[model samples]
Structure formats: C-alpha cells, structure tokens
Target chain A: MSTIPEDLSYTKEHEWVAGLDDGRTVTVGVTAYAAEQLGDVVYVQVPEVGAAVTAGDAVGEVESTKSVSDIFAPVTGEVVEVNAAVVDDPSLVNSDPYGEGWLFRVQIGEEPEDLLTSAEYTSLTTAES
Target chain B: MSRSTPLREVHEALGATLTDFAGWLMPLRYGSESVEHNAVRTAAGLFDLSHMGEIFVTGPQAGEALDYALVGWLSALDTGRARYTMIVDGNGHVLDDLIVYRLAPEEFLVVANAGNYPMVARELTERAGSYDARVEDRSESFALVAVQGPKSAEILAKLTEADLDGLKYYAGLPATVAGFEALIARTGYTGEDGFELFVRNEDAVPLWNALSEAGAGLGLLPAGLSARDTLRLEAGMPLYGNELTEEQTPFDAGLGRVVRLDKPGDFVGRAALAERAAQPDQEDGPGADALRLVGLVARGRRVPRHGYPVTRDGVVVGEVTSGAPSQSLGKPIAMAYVSRSAVEAGGLTVDIRGSHEPVDVVDLPFYRRSK
Candidate 1:
C-alpha cells in the first residue's frame, strides 16, 4: 500500500529526496504515508526560492484539519524553486504525494549521505501507523 | 487510561486510526476525512460517544442542586427534555459545557465532556451537598450511541416505539429502541435531526449491530472523531477545546443567551457573571487586553491555523483559535478572538504567512442547511 522508490533518499520525518534531471538539484516532497496521515492538508507554507536551508531544519509548516506539522528538509541546500500549485491545491499531496505534489527542489551543495533508503523509510512509516 | 468502548474492537477491526483522547482509545477515522465528512453530510453516520461523562443526580432537591451547579434553570425543565448549559467556575469561566436531561421529577442525568469529567463531577458533587441530591457517575456502566443526519430518523423510526418527531429538538423521551431500553434524545452536535441513545454497556454491541443493519438501507456509515469535527464545524458549532475552554466564558463564546441571570437565585458563578455583565463593555476587560471571539473565512484554499495572527492594515489584531477547510463550505475558515475595537472597525484581516487577508465578521453557523 506504499510507494517508496529506491531512486530517492528519505528522512525520518518522511520526506523523499529525488535527484532532479539537472543533477545539481534534488526534488523534495513528503512521502505518501505522511500525507495520508496528515488528513486533508488545508495549508502549506513552503519556503521561497533561493532561501538557504540546512539539513533537519523545518522548511515549512503543513496544517491539516485537526493538527499542524512542520515539514523538514533532508538535505543541506538552497531552495531553487517552490511548487506554488501544490500550495494552492493541497489535496494534490494527498492524491499524488510523490510526483506532481513535490514540495520543492533544492540546489543542494551537500546531499546527506545518512539519508534513509526507501526500504528504511517504508519500515519507519509503517511502524508509525 | 484503562477502559475501551465496545466500538473499540470494531474500529480496529475496520482498520480505524486510533487516538488516545481523554483516556479513551477512540477512532479518529477509518480512512479519508473527506469521505467521512461526506458520509455524514450525505446520509447517516454513527458515533461512539460512550466516552462522554454521564452523571446522575437524584433526590428531592436535585433540581435545586443543578440550578446552583450550572448556569441554567433546571427547575423549569419537563421530564422528557434536555437543555444545554455551562458549568462555570468561580470566575464564571466555563468549566465544561454540557446537556442536562431531566429523566424524572427528581432525577437528572448530566452529560459532560470526556476531558473534564472528574473536575465537573467533583465540582458538582461539592455544590450538591447542600441540597438533598445524590450524584452518581454512570460513565462506565452505560454507553452512548448517536445516529445523526437526515436519514437517521427514517432508519430509527422503524425500530423505536416512541414518537421521534413529536419529541422536538432538545427534548428526550423514555422509550424502547431496537428492543433495548434506552432514552432517546433528539439532540446532537451536528445541525441535524437525530437521536442519541443511552444503553447499558452490555447491550451496546447488539444495539450497534441493529442500528447498523437498519441503517444499511439509508447509506449509513460508522463515523469517527474526524467526521464529528467537520460536521460540527459545518454547523458552526464550537468544540470544547477550541471554542470553549477554562479561560472562556459562555457569554464571550456567543452563548450569552443561554444564561438566565434573572431566574430565582444563586449559582456557582453568579456574582462573577453579574459583575461581567454590568461592566461597561470594556474594550479590554479588567486585568487583560480586550478580547472577543470572531469568525474568519479565507478567500482561497489556504487555511489560517491556530495562533496565526489576525491583522488589519498591517497591524496584528487577533490570533486564530480554530480553523479548517470546511468540507461543506468548500473554503478555508477560522474563528479567533479579536479586540473589541478591531471588531468594531468594520473590515478586518488575518495574517496568513506574511500577507494580510481580509475576513468577514458575520453571524455564526458559517454553513447553513440548504436541503
């Protein structure tokens, strides 16, 4: 019931990091499990482009119907671009969390080698349920 | 910390996501919140409300006791009726908002919020000493099941001998429903005509099954706290934690009319309420900046959350108390307490992120029954 692509790196916070086709940037988004549990994300405050961010820093906040959660960054990078479409339409995260609803792309100077693998992320989120 | 409702196993069986709210392992939802919200709005939905605290007050002076315990007149209630009242503290601040049902001439059942059960019971019992009333906590021995929505009455009418329609809103009738001896109350949190059934703990499962079976034809689904929240929000109803709390008085929460100050005699917070009412509507009441509850509807899909600042002309004015993208309204809306000056200034704005967005100061019940 989960889709965790092996091509990406993961975080304990359930964010997925995929190296973009440009190679210099990595696309970041929350995993399907995290989005599902968040329950109808009503608001997303994503960081703007060119904002400097460190690994494990809260990049933004996502609010659901019942509670609010901080979206964490898995790699040390500068925000290259934000997905305004997803910010306008939060249900996209619920529907296509990994693909079109990708949170943002960061031009990371250093991608964390300690990032979890897809298998590890799946195991973690499954245990969380 | 220990007890689980009869629906616990059923919830887990149906793969519901469970949460420990008020020491009860209640299901927040079985699946999607959107689907759950739609289910209750479209057809019928069942709620396991056994976690609600039920206290019985009996004896000749029970009516007098409750009148003093609550900010409501209990002496005037008919046997088969219920009233929504607030249990206030010494400051007239709400301890808990509850529904008191007069079951008999001298007996009443006070239903309280799950989180404030012990405090409410203790506060009430202490005040009940002067009167001839004896208090009993029936939370563990009894179970509550609420079937709500337009289809609820149709499904239940087939099983209950009582005249459900005759029992108007906020009224109760002693009757047998689905062969279970229960008190059928035409009262609910959702803005709909429905019944809340109170039964023995042992009979909960069967009653649930019978209701489920009968509801099958009416598109009924077992709803959880998720649906409950959205449904109540659509109805513009306030939650205990969000709208009403220890710091909030019923009068400030837009429930001032529920207090009958002129009625015979003293309540727990009578002097305080009288003082509050008599004080010239202070922009900021004594010892604090002026604050009053108000609603906000964001223009777009963006939801303004709790603690987010409400601004006007680039000045921070208020903070969001509770907010959600309403399933029924199809837009993001919020409730917050703004300064009386800000509210009177006509137009207002809420600071969503860095941008200040305008908010409409309208009447409550943001969503109305269109059907």
Candidate 2:
C-alpha cells in the first residue's frame, strides 16, 4: 500500500501539499501511489521559480520509461523554489517520493479549500489500485 | 474484458503491473522496467510470449501456399529452419511481419503479431484455396516462453536434453523440457542468444515454474512487455503498429530484402514489389526518394515519444514511430521515417511537445552484444 502522511493534504491528480498548516508557503510533490504507477521516472520538468500558477493548471511534466504525465498545480500560488536535485537525478522521485523528491514550493496567493485530507486521499488511491 | 494468458495468475502473484495490450492482459513490468531490461542484456530474462499468435500450415502443398501468402520463398526453406518474412496486401502494403518455421516436410508454423494474426489466418486460408494446404490458428491452445541473454544457454541446459551446441540461430527442434513436450526454437527478439519454447497451454504454469527454479541461480528474472519493447527498440527491430502499418510497404521500412523477387512462381503483391525493385537505385537503397526509416538519438533528457513530429528548420519532415530511454545506450533513442531530402539536408530535431530537441542521426541498432 502507498503511504499517505496524515499531516499533508492531496489533490485528485495525486500531488501532495505539505506545510499547508503554516498558511504561507507549501511544498508539493507527487504522492507515493502516483510514483508506483509511473514505474521509473527518467526526466522531470518543473515550473520555473516565480511563475504564477492557478489551481489545476498543468505546470510541469513527469516522464517515465513507458509514459508521461502532467504535474498539476494543487493550489493557486507563485512558485518560490524548484528542486534542482530531482532534475539532475530523476530516480529520486521513485526512490524517495515524499522526502527528497519534492518538486517545487509555492507562495500561496489565496487560501485553498478543495484539497483532500489524508483520509480522503487514502480512499482515492485505494479505489484506483 | 480483455483475454488472459495461461500465466496470468503467475504474473499477478509476482505483483506485476498488468496492462491491456492488443486485447490481451499482459504484464507491463514486475519491478523497475530498466532493471528488467538490464537483466536481459547482462544475464537472462524470462518472457511469457503466449500472447503472440501461432498459425500452423500443414499438408503437402504448405510451402507453396506460404510462398503465395507471404513475401519470402518459403518453399526454399529447409525443415527445422526459420525465416523472417512479411505478408503484404495486393497493393504491396505490409499487412503483418511473420516468422515462418518449417517443422516438418509438410508442416510450417507461422508466428504473427497478436493484433494481426486473425487477419493473417483469414488471408492465408483465402489465398490457399487452390492449393492442397490447411491453415489452422493454434494460438488459443499454445503457449510460448522465452529465455534471453548471455546466460540463457547455461540456464536452459539444466532443463532440456536438446543439443544446445548443435542448435543454430533460427532453428527449432522438438525436445522434452521439464518433462513437457515442447518445440525449442533458438529465436528471440531481444538481440541476445536465447531460446523460445512452444508448449501446450495446459503445460505453461508448471513449465514456467520449472524454468524459474532451474534458472534461479543464473540471475534470471521474469521480464515484461515494457522491457521487451525497449530491448527490441535497441536492436532496431520494427514493431507492427509503430514502425510498420498497412499503409507502408516493406520497402518503406528498409526491409525490402525480405521480399524475394526472384522466386519462380508469382506471389501476392509480386507485380507491385517487382516494380519497386525495378526502381533506380539511390544512395542508401531502393526507395530513397520516399520517406526512409532512420534512427535518432536525443541530445536532451526529455524523451521523444510516438507520434511526435521529426522536424528540420521548424518544418515537419518525418514522424517518430518508436522512442524510449534506452538502458543500453544510456540515451534516449527513436526510430523515425524522415524524407530523403531532409536526411540529406541534416539538422534534425524531434518536436518533443512544443520544444524542438536536437537529435543526431545514427545507424539502426543502437546496441549489439559482443560474441
């Protein structure tokens, strides 16, 4: 079973939002369930820092050996930082999806309300699997 | 619902990620596909190829029927030997690529792609109307398993009494494997030394278990279609739907040599293929003025996928048929059909999404194993 940390919020697109409790900046990465489905990640294209993104916008892409998927923005925000480590070695997304595989951080523009709690995210992943 | 192979339960037990392929449920991968691909290159990889279609042609005139049905001169093929050939429509467009194995004096087994076998069987039956031959589709009752890599021979030696040293490439012989009656064919698509075992569907699970047990010490792992695709791509083999289609002739894919124009009798697409063969020679080969298949290695990390346009100077000159991150080459490679003039002009790039990624044109087959 894929791990769903109780402290983070998630979107239906399978991205997890961390540090949302602080109400200012939040780190985002694809969930463990999404990583498992994607097999091996070979390339990662993250949004540039300082770019404004609306919720549900496809801001980046995650490419694997078999297929490619869009990285949707979980909330409306301006990109604060992008992970350069994952860009250099994409396998980190498969090996450590939650900790070091974070894609980017965003400075929130408005409070997000549609993100799912950990329990809801668990149910969604369970249904998919 | 998709059809399940005989080893469906085995794949499920191994925690493989299953995907629908050509109306059959097949394992895409058990773990990391790259690891599986590497295993096949360095050691050995087992593959459940039961999804491929097996059509048997038998009787005194089987050779004549196949010669008329396919491009190659099957009648000239000796028993126990196999030849790669293709079936084309009346217009000379490739219907499907096939491997014809002569099992006996009057019997031949034609292995075809899963998606095109039904049509191939129907076409063969129709074409053999005047000949004393019988075509049978035995795909539902037969199971195919392959062991591929440098260590394949060592692993298979433990199971069968067949003369491993005597068996040549593209040869098949009946043998008892793990106490099961099987036709061991020294053939594979992974560009490695290997053997493909054809057995009854009921014997699949036990045979797989026995091979797995025997090969456990030789670093053998169960590979999936995902790995198989990359392996064949690195070997520069043309896939059915990707590199070949009903709209393209074998000449278009640089495989015109498979068409035997000098055969005594007239075969299907004979006149059209002869016309193509009569065309004036070009720098590369026949049909150089038309779109020619070429290999592309990407300079950037972003992979170029199927259906992506091959561009030069912002103009679409060709299209990518197959592309993947090659484990053997340590780079992203692809097969695309570029126009002859564009190939001569140089400066090729694949339009990956919106960005034009520069690519180098190289010879087909990005990887070859050392003997």
Candidate 3:
C-alpha cells in the first residue's frame, strides 16, 4: 500500500525521479515503500552539491534504526542541490517520504531510458512486499 | 517456510510488519518501533514472546540435574524464584542463556532462546540420563506475553486477583489471569518492572485483548522485537548470539558471577571454569588476549551496526556485537568486544562502513531506569 505517484518515475533501486518531463533538473527521493521497510530513519547522508554522478552510482546513504541502505543516482548528472532539512532531521524521510523528504536534485546529462512508470513501479513494489 | 506463532493472525490483523526471526514469523513493529520503545520506558509496552522456548524439567532430581547441567546452582534456588543462568558446553563455551523458574518443589521451567532451545533440550535430556528427571519441550503448547514498564504492576493487578505487591522481582507463581490459567512470573528483558504471563497457546488472543483493554488509558502499545532489542541494549543485557557465543564463556562476557564454582557437586565445565576463575589476569591464560565486552556511545550521528570493526588509530581492535540509535540517550550506542590492551590505551573508534567514527567508551548499560 505504498504511494506511487503517477507523475513520478522509479528505479529498481527504489529511488523516484520527478521532473522527468522537464528533462533538465530533476528531484529525487526514496519511495515510501523503501522508507517503510527501513523502519525509523535515524541518519541520512546525501551527495555534496556540485558532485558529478552517474546512474546507479551509490552517492549517499540512508540509515534507519535497524539497518542502512545506499541511495543511488537514478540518472546521470551533476548534483545540483541537497536537502539540508532531511539531512538535519532524517525522520522526515519516514514522515513525508514523497514530499519534504526529497534527498537531492540532479541536472540531466542524457535522456533517461530505464526508469519505470507509475504502473510498473506499483507492480515492482507489489512483488517486493 | 518459516514457522508461525499462534499470534501471527492477530499481528497481521493489526497491520504489523512481519519479519523472520530465528525461524519464526513474528511482528517487527505495528506502527513505529521508537514509539514502542519509549512507551516501554515511560508507561508500558506489551510483547509477544511466544517465539521463545519453554522446557519443563520435573522430578525429585530435577534440581540436582539442572545444577549439574547449567552454570548456576539451581538446586539451591527456592521455589517461586527464578535465576538468570546459562547452559555451557564441556569446554565452558556458552550454549544458551536461560532463565530458570522453580514453580514447585520438583518442577522447574527453563526458558531459552528460540534458536537454541532444541539443542538445550537435547543436552539437558542427555545430561539427566542418570538422574530421575524428565525433560519436556513444551514450547509449542505455550505462548508468552510480557507487560513491561513502570506501570506494569498496576495494569496486571486489574486482570488477576494475585497479590501484585507481594511478588518480588525474579519470582513467579501460578495464577488465574482473566479467567485463564497462567504462570505469572515477575521477569522481563526490558530492564523494567514487568510480568511475563505463560499461558496456553489458545489463550493468547483473549489474554492479549484483556490486557489491552485494561491498559487502554495507561499508555500500553503492542511492542515488537525491534523495540525489545533497543531496550535490552540500553539496559546492558547481553544477547545470546551477539554477546554470548559458543567460542566465548560467561567470564569473557564479564558475567562470570553467574558461574558457581563453590557448589558442592561436579558440574559441566567445572574444571575449565575453575582454572579461568583462578588466573583471570594471567597473560598466558585462555582469554588473556581475547577481546572484552564494553559499551560505546557514538560521537557522531551515524549508528554503528553488528559486525562493524572497532579501531584504534586505524588498527582493528574489536568488533561491534549490538548497536542502535538509543531513544533514551538521544545518541547512537553500541556494545562491542574490545581487546584488553585497546581498552587500557583509550582512544577507541568504530569503523562505520570505512569511516572511523570517534566513540567514547563508557560503562556497560548506556541507560538505566531511575528507581
């Protein structure tokens, strides 16, 4: 029963990409399904602003009470922005995973081709749960 | 497929997140584990400990049999009292940490960790071959429910007519709870004042419902194993797999007091334990160079997890056994086994995923409930 927004694109690693329609600067955050599975989030590490990254690169880490996970770059680009609010308070990732819990933003380097649609992401999460 | 407890359906109905633990499917959390942990620390929290193993040893020689099988002098334990003890191999390595409750003059209940009970039962049976004791693994027929916190006594008092004021810590008595038969033991793993109700499997749901209703206004939540881990960690309790292992002894974990070498008869690991007790500080002894267990509080926000290495100036000194973001301390805390030399030299850090996070080595038990 995770919220999968129709406007967003997802990766197999559970990161959701917003603004794919714009194809320039896109926002990224972990899906609600990933956050719920991690239990209570305690710490978050996001890539530094202006760092260059590629798709599937482990740029940051999300640590919950019981375990930790890697945050991968959904698309290749330079890190445009990082969420200081979520870094300061990691619980935001659990409280508002789709909104205020956005991890970072990246400028698109190439056309993203492997992203999953909302329907596809729903099936992926369903299979996982 | 993993085994399911009798409360599995009830947990599923509550929308709990189920996880496999020691081959059993049990609830990890219902809503938030932190909230459950805090509730247990402040008010109360209910736990389904049915996954734990319950073995009964009964007969005229039951006490003597346990006295030889376990590390403690159980034969000297009075009826209605419980002892925190362990079953060790001949080499003095820990098999499992157990809580033995003497229910009658000739009946004793041995509660063990879920993963080690079968072996414990088999070992106890083999050890009691010459004695007149009968060992029965009654784990499948029993369900354990624990109400833990400062207000546990008050909540339990409403459901049973038993004398709550008279029950001392680490004591148990048979009582009728909510019109069901149960062995009410004043024992808990959360390091709080609590009662563990051992009832038949069929009585679990209704008993849970009754306790929930009685504790409605007193702030009791259905807690899971995740919360239970943090609570016990803060209390400095050693987990069986994390702290006690087959390669280590109780003395190595800094819990040698539970071993009674002065007891009259010969017991398992008597010779080895006596030798260890005699020359505890000898450099050439068995565990002289081995890592000793200690508590660590992270100087940074990142939590240290199991199997992480403890380092001193980039040199690996020990390994973290258990760790978590403590709700009470508001900082990450961990229990680890560090070499004696590293402990004396000070300046300890946990290598958290390749980052040497500075840590302060405090005394065991990062948090203690104010009495």
For all predicted structures, in order, the TM-scores are 0.90, 0.98, 0.98
Score residue B282 of candidate 1 by CA lDDT: 28
Q: What is the TM-score of chain B in candidate 1?
A: 0.94
TM-score of chain A of 1: 0.92
> Which docking category, incorrect, acceptable, medium or high, applies to candidate 2?
high
**Each candidate: fraction of true contacts kept?**
0.82, 0.94, 0.82
Which stretches of model 2 miss by more than 4 angstroms?
B282-289
Estimate, for each residue in B1-371, the C-alpha lDDT of model 2 and write its tens digit: 99999999999999999999999999999999999999999999999999999999999999999999999999999999999999999888999999999999999999999989999999999999899999999999999999999999999999989898899999999999999999999999999999999999999999999989988988999999999999999999999999999878788888989999888898999998887777765223454457889999999998988999999999999999999999988889999989888888899999999999999999988888899
Across residues B12-117, which tens digit of lDDT does each residue of candidate 3 receive?
A: 9988999999999999999899999999999999999999999999999999999999999999999999999999998888999999999999999999999999
Model 2, A29-66: lDDT tens digits are: 99889999999999999999999999999999999999
Cα misplacement distance, residue B135 of candidate 3 (Å): 1.0
Q: Order the candidates by lDDT, highest first — what do you get?
A: 2, 3, 1
On a 0 to 100 scale, what is the lDDT of residue B55 in model 2?
98
Winning candidate number (DockQ): 2
User: Candidate 1 vs candidate 3: which has greater DockQ?
Assistant: 3
Clashing pairs in 2: none
Residue-level lDDT tens digits of model 3 in A1-129: 578889999999999999978659999999999999999999999999999999988999999989999999999989999999999999999999999999999998877879999999999888888
For candidate 1, what is the lDDT?
0.83
